[model samples]
Target: MVGVLAAAVAVLAVVTGLNLVLLFAVIRKLRTTEARLGTAPVATLPKQGSEIGSFLIAAEDDSMISDASIGDGMTVACVMPGCAPCKTQIAAFRERPRSAPEKTVFFVFGGQGEPETEELVTSLAGLGQVAVTQTAGAVGVALDDVTSFPTLLRTEGGRIAAVGRTWEDIGAVAVATVR
Candidate 1:
């Protein structure tokens, strides 16, 4: 019985170490991929339809939502930090005109560390007027399932008109759908 217990403990330790190594490998791979596949800012907004609506965003500082309603002719750009794709998307969104009837909202999705989050918000503030919200718990995670990072969802008149993987694709789809 003593021998069996000792063997079990040794095996467990080996498995744990292996798991840690695998996790590190996976993380490194993801980072490399992101670095290699850098995206450029897109010109002009994507196509969208007449289904704009209100989308609730949990604010980080305040209890109320920052930006929820897009109205009928407005556009909303949602962004997550630490995602290379998201960073590129943000740059594109930043270039857009404030009076251009499109609204961009920045949310802190699961990525990077707290310091990175602060930097992202600060950088976005420099871009132009935008709504920054902080989501709590699994709600943000759940929202991510529906619209993952580097994703752009276009809502017109309170309904989802188009959604895409990259900001350019989504923006194009949204712009087209809106008109």
Candidate 2:
């Protein structure tokens, strides 16, 4: 009986040791897989260093906004109504100015006649030029990566210097202004 107990303990120890070894092997494989994928996240935001395509849009206030609108150090924030995160993102932007008001352009996505769309556009006017669109439509077709709401980015020389959901990720690169 004593021999049997000792053998059982030894078997369990070996099994545990083998499990640890396999765990380490799996972790190593996952790390390699991540590296193989180039560390590009599955986010909808455009990849940093990629150039944004040109566009000419009509702001809700009848202003003509173009690619030049975001020239140099402008920050572009795309948000949508009914998305809690979008509201939070904008609220944060309003509370803490990350870039110059003139350098920040907001694209609000929603149905053409939706009341919430108008409200969103109105609220963002204090920030800068605000555009209301029936959908991601043109912007989506142009920036393919801008399919998600609450995307914040700064472009420099037409290339995306930084892109993220929060200002902290892009704040430093944009034209600085306090509110």
Candidate 3:
């Protein structure tokens, strides 16, 4: 029994050592990748105050939604099926007081046959018009900076007022009231 216990301890120590070595290797690789990446974004978003890219999204009611149709200052939220923070972004829009339902738009980016697409579109019901599409839609082609899922942008006169990955960056309370 004592010999068996000793063997178990030795085995556990070996396993522990292997785990540590693997962990160190992972950490080293991560550091190297981070250094290589620096601060470059995969894609750039449209600059603030620039004319936003043109996009046409069909609402559930069959009405067409485009950058031109958003009344006055428009608040646009871009989210995807796999994005985790996207849920929080939706919650923020739902829980917080919004300015105008007509002026709000949520882009649910997903290809056909994506299971989570329905859930996202359904959750966005009544909050604003929901547009489920693949490949970032026309906005990506125009803005190029919408690579980050859950990006929130406020635009007026076909130009972007403010945009960011978080609500605070664009101002939750402040942005709610028209600029």
lDDT of each: 0.53, 0.78, 0.74
Clashing residue pairs in candidate 2, if any? Answer: none
Q: Which stretches of candidate 2 lie over 4 Å from their true place?
A: 1-43, 172-179
Clashes of each: 24, 0, 3
TM of each candidate vs. truth:
0.48, 0.69, 0.68
Q: Per-residue CA lDDT of candidate 3, range 1-179, in tens? A: 99999999999999999999999999999899989998664745557877776777787657888767754567788888878898987787777745467767877778755678887788888887777766646756554456777778777777778888777766646335343
lDDT of 1: 0.53
lDDT of 1 by residue, 55-105 (tens): 454444333442244444344455666678778766665554332432444
What order do candidates take by TM-score, descending? 2, 3, 1
TM-score (C-alpha, index-matched) for candidate 3: 0.68
Q: Model 3, stretches more than 4 Å misplaced?
A: 1-44, 174-179
The best candidate in terms of TM-score: 2
Instruction: Give the range of the ten consecutive residues with the poorest summed lDDT in model 2.
Output: 170-179
**Model 1: what TM-score?**
0.48
